[model samples]
Target: MNNINSGWRSGILEKIQGRLMKVYLLARRFRKHIKDLKNIPRTPRCGLSKQETIINKH
Candidate 1:
């Protein structure tokens, strides 16, 4: 029956929508984490040049 088909379709659509929402939430969280990392200042690479020269002599 058409009614049964519609009900089945609706159920599948709901499942798909639920998955999309979960992915969206996860993506949002991942983006926020990436932003937090970007905001952190990087430490200066002091003394690395001296170490590289010392290693290259071998």
Candidate 2:
């Protein structure tokens, strides 16, 4: 009877650990995605080099 109880407890613990690992992985991916989004606006827009040259001539 004791062995059965111990086995059941270990099974539950394993399930909990698996769930935590999944959440941690998801959080890491989310952080990277957020970082990429933050960089998008800081990047210079495309096709503006011609305007920049005209302005620089002044």
Candidate 3:
């Protein structure tokens, strides 16, 4: 009976560990993606000027 209990506990523990690892990897990937976005340069707001011109013409 004790052996069966231990086996069941180990199985649950392994499942928990696997889920934790997946979450950790996903978080790491998200952080890297955010870092890459930050490294990109900002562009001027030309779209706003175009919109203003169109509004003025109407």
- Compute the lDDT of residue 33 as modeled in candidate 3: 57
Clashing pairs in 1: none
Q: Could you say which candidate leads in TM-score?
A: 2
Could you say which candidate leads in lDDT?
2
Candidate 3, residue 2: lDDT: 100
Local accuracy of candidate 3 as per-residue lDDT tens digits, 1-58: 9999999999999999999999999899777755645544463467555544654573
Q: 1-58, model 1: which lDDT tens digit per residue?
A: 9999999999999999999999999899777755645544453455455444654573
- The count of residue-pair clashes in candidate 2 stands at 0
Score candidate 3 by lDDT: 0.73
Task: Give lDDT for model 2.
Answer: 0.74
Model 1 accuracy (lDDT, Cα) = 0.71
**lDDT scores in order:** 0.71, 0.74, 0.73
Better of 1 and 3 by TM-score: 1
**Candidate 2 Cα errors over 4 Å, as ranges:** 44-58
